[model samples]
Target: MARYIFVTGGVVSSLGKGLSSASLGYLLKSRGYKVKIRKLDPYLNIDPGTMNPFEHGEVFVTDDGAETDLDLGHYERFIDINLTSLDNVTTGKIYSQILEKERSGKYLGNTVQVIPHVTNQIKDFIKAKTSGYDFIICEIGGTVGDIESLPFLEAIRQFSNDIGKDKSLFVHLTLVPYLKSSEEIKTKPTQHSVKELRSLGIQPDIIVCRSEITLPKGQRKKISLFCNVNIENVIQTVDVKTIYEAPISFYKEKFDYQVLKHFNIKNKKQPNLKPWYRTKNIILNSKKEVNIFVVGKYVDLKDAYKSIDEALIHGGLANSIKVNLNKIDSEKLKKNQIKNKLKNADGILIPGGFGKRGTEGKIQCIKFARENKIPFFGICFGMQLSLIEFARNVLKLRNANSTELNKNCIPVIGLIEEWYKDGMLKKGDLKKLGGTMRLGSYECNLNEKSMVKKIYKSKKIYERHRHRYEVNIAYKNKFESKGLIFSGLSNNNKLTEIIELNSHPWFVGVQFHPEFKSRPLSPHPLFASFIKAAKNKK
Candidate 1:
């Protein structure tokens, strides 16, 4: 008997519905209610796994291995909850399941239609998964008027009736544009957006308005009158300095009070949001700043490097400093013309990516970092490139290459691999393209005297990984002899988890995605240490 809060956006997309939903969930949780957030994407793609980062932003992977929308990343960071594949759904996945059932003759030769069949599947999904929680805050992707979202809207509308109106509430987020020439905020867009929702048989209980400035009392009353919501329930959301400040800001605006009143839940103890407020103050009042260059192929889209960016920010927070990130295109460095771009950066970081394009540039950047004794951190493919650079320069392997690029490469960095997971062989040929190599979290045993162990202050640690190729272990001793310390290894002693340079001030590479687990309150240790080292370089 969980109460449902359906969140939808109008006027336009990117209205911060995801953040708003997460903030609401946080507020509700603080009031002593069990809360869970779910996302319903209207896209036809089964998941974001195969989509390009430029097209769709970052594909967030869950503990249960669901490649989900980047908003799930925000959800996890805000709530400290580990989401699973079941937490997100798209039109493509819903229809694919229905079609499979049809193909198997499970429908008994009935003609399939969007209404009873598709909508039924959607409703079933909602009802089945959301049964036990106190509040299930579901955010619908896309705007209200989009054609792809019509069925989802219909399903939610019907679900409200089925569950009774008292148990369900709709929160519509809309943009209130301010015309600079007129110097006045317009409410016409929100008025029309509400009209659209009303046409679809859904009435919003709360209206979260996004604007550059606070709405005047007159404008708020006008919107309340037109949209059929109380003036008190019409909340204004202005731009904040940091995303972490959202909960505190919204709470001050009485967002949780409105939600509880709408759902008829008694308020418990007052929320203690001092931690979020303190984090924002620390970021805003920092006296020191350090610039770090993140070299990657997906520089055009910030979401592709979402976790990495946040982790670096967290690092800055740990040191009470500001981290100014310079997004450097790895492809541009292929011509050896990026010296000017690298000049002012206190540290250089090469993040993970796929394919062979721009890899040589990444290797070149690694060489530059190593030669200059700059603080450097490499991840996944970045780690592989570091080894390749070391092999070419120090090992004197003239044509050092990865097996991913040159399949027949001598002393290949990539090899056809098999992993023993719980004594079972998940067989897949190395030649195949999709879903190979090590994925998800695995344990790594850190060398006791290594820099990584000292930084983490632990002998055993686990981190999430997403990569296809690994460094050839046969070259381990040779590379170690050349001063590359094998700082971390898998429990079985076969896979390398971390590597560092003993002679350099701060240089490390990890095969896992540490950024995925970083938070504003709890920065990842590696990033915190890296930023500290970068500050020292300054």
Candidate 2:
């Protein structure tokens, strides 16, 4: 039987509930307890796949192809756990499943309602997935009073009662705003937030207060008294310099201790946080710094490039330097404005994206990087653009383009198709949009004496991929003859990856999402090498 901790946010959004949950999971895992974390989103979207990166940020893809909320990425990085599609659930997904069953006559005309139908579905999701783990940390998306999140809250309240109070606990994350006019910290919002939560039959056992300044003893006691939680359970979560410091910082504040004490988790040994501590030292006290420009469409919202941004930071930790990222809109390059934005950059990176919106700009950036000998890295769609740029300018192929944009692209760098697990072809000679692509981790054999091989220090590597079109094999020979190297390939001799200008300073690209696997304590070798190359350019 696993003990459950349901985390909720109140007073406001952006309260670091996801980080808090992840940090607690790390502490529990360090104590030799098996743990799993789950995220319940209250949004109506069945998945984040169709959501705009600019509107909702990056849609994190799980190993099993679940387009999930970005918080799941936090869970994976902090706890070193591989999350699956089963780990994340949205209200839209739950209701859709139930409605699908109802339409199929599986409901037997029960006149589906929220109480036993929707709420029961949520409870079932929790109970079915939590069988093996000793502790299940579940974070509910949105604040307590959100109308969209009511069903989820009601389900959790009933779940706690059904599982017995001893087996479940609730942690409320609320804001402690500082009033500049009064020169004082306010606690009224938290009181009201708690009161709202209590109205729904859910009382938080612990309160994680988000504040810019440390909450004084008097303030902490007052919050505890009004919020109806213990004084020790009122954990203060102040902002830190680097998010990697979260595990160590929370440990010092006894965030894990309070959690264990609430659930009576006795005799649990402390976690050995040597790796995190070392990473923090490398990031904060490093002697060097490098600037890298991230050329992409979703530059306004930082979360759109959340994983890529953090991966660069991790690379800085690996090389004992600070990474200063300059977000440049790729669309600006179509008008020849990218050069001004990238003039001071030590390196240039083009991350993955969809459609042909700003692709011309991306191709122009790739051309500039190749010509100027700038340290360059292209990921997924970015990799395809690099090949297209090389084909059109260097090889002088007049009709080079990605099949994604034009199905009849002459020197097709991207083709609409699906390759199977056993080297078989699927949707042969047919084009379908929904779920027709190579997704998840796949092995690629790296050629010896190649840039990728040298960076990885391994002949074979597996990386996560999420794209449909690949470099057309028919054009492989022509591209290779023109100095473009197909240095990494699948076992079937399919060109799954590429690198360029071996004699040049630094240039590489891959058709995989390496950012998905990078961790603060363990930076990806490619990013580390790219940053190192950038530093050398300085």
Candidate 3:
């Protein structure tokens, strides 16, 4: 049986519960214990699939095509695990399933309530497909006192009793605000937060306190006394130079030791955190740096491209260089302002996004990057825009654009009307917008002589995608004749997966999102190559 560690937060939001959980999971995994991390969001959006990036941040897609919360990105990066849709559970997903069961008469005319029915659904989702794992760290989203999260909290409380306390552990993360003027840290908020959690019938076995500075011995004792936790189990987490240092920091504090002790499990081996230490050292001590401009619509919100941001850092780590990301909002970018905006750019990257809000500005940026011979990388929507830019400038196609932006213009890119997957036909609907894209991992065959093939050193590669539009293959011959390279193809040469410019110093675009798979230990080949190209340009 897998011991469950339920991570909950209080006092405020954005307390780094996800990171804390992932770091602990990494610590245990390094000590030869099988570990898995999951997220239980209290939101009612089914998933983050249809939610706006500005409101909910990036929607992380798993290999099985589930659009999940951005925290899953942190989990995957830290634990180095490939999670599936089953790892993420939300109130929206739980309620949707319950309603479907009710409509299908699965309840046999019984009145449904939140207690037995809804809570049962949440518990079931928690324990699904979790066999053979020594530990499962489940982070509950939202703060402790939020009304929407009450059901989830109650569900976990019930789960603890049902599974026996020995098989369950609750780790509560709370903030300890430090007043500069008073020069003292406050533990009152943590006390009240733990009190609130206790009111929900859940007592935390460990208290992870988030603070700007180290907690004094007095403050730690006070928190332990008020929160009803052991003094040794009260862990203090301060801001680190980089997030990758979190696991090492927590390991030094013996956070994993307390977790193992709680279950009365003995592990003789120590955690091997050499990879994290090396990654952190490289991140902080790297001398060379490259500036890259990431032009996108959601640039204002840093979390909007969380995975992309991390992936770039991973790429830089692989090259022993520091990546300076200048996030440029495409919607506000003017044609004349391109030079000033990207003046120091060693590389130009256009990340994935939806909508036509900043289409023209993105195309303008692509044109500047291409004409100036700056190393450029485009992904998903950015790739389509690159094709449009190429068609308008090189192919001399008048007013070239994607059908997503303008239906009347020349269809340099158009909606994927039909596609084949595993010998079965699939189609997307223009009316419905949720969970309908060509998502998850797909295989792409690389041209033997292509630049990507040289970078990846493989003829076939699999990448994850989350888009509805594809470049028209009929223009491939025209594009290839004009020095454009359609270097990768999927679905038996019908879909374009990668594109490059033959004449430029380094310009590439990929139809799939490679950022999802990039890791610090082993960065994705494309991002690593992109960083190397940027460094070479510098």
Winning model by TM-score? 3
Least well predicted 10-residue stretch by lDDT in candidate 2: 418-427
Each candidate: RMSD: 3.3, 3.0, 3.1
Task: Compute each candidate's TM-score over C-alphas.
Answer: 0.94, 0.94, 0.96
Superposed model 3: Cα runs more than 4 Å off: 418-435
**Can you write out model 2's per-residue Cα lDDT over 1-538, one digit (the tens) per residue?**
7999999999988889999999999988988888999999999999887899988888787777667888898999989898988888999999999999999999898899999999999998877766789999999999999999999999999999998999999999999998888889999999999999999999999888888888999999999898888899898888888787888888888988877777787845888899888888877887788989999999989899999998898888888888988888887565457677678889999999999888988888888888899999999998888888888897788688876787555645544353321323443533442246667777799888788888899999988777877777666777778777889998777555666666569888888888888888678898888889998999
lDDT of 2 at 113: 96
Give the lDDT of residue 31 in candidate 3.
92
lDDT of 3 by residue, 75-139 (tens): 89888999999999899999999999999999999999999999999999889989999998999
Computed on alpha carbons, the lDDT of every model, listed in order, comes to 0.87, 0.85, 0.91
- Evaluate model 3: give its TM-score: 0.96
Which clashing pairs does model 3 show? none
Q: Candidate 1: global Cα-lDDT?
A: 0.87
* Reference-based TM-score, model 2: 0.94
Over 4 Å off in model 2, which ranges?
Answer: 334-336, 417-435
lDDT of 1 by residue, 387-433 (tens): 98999899999687886787545443664353222332233533352
Model 3, residue 181: C-alpha shift (Å): 1.1
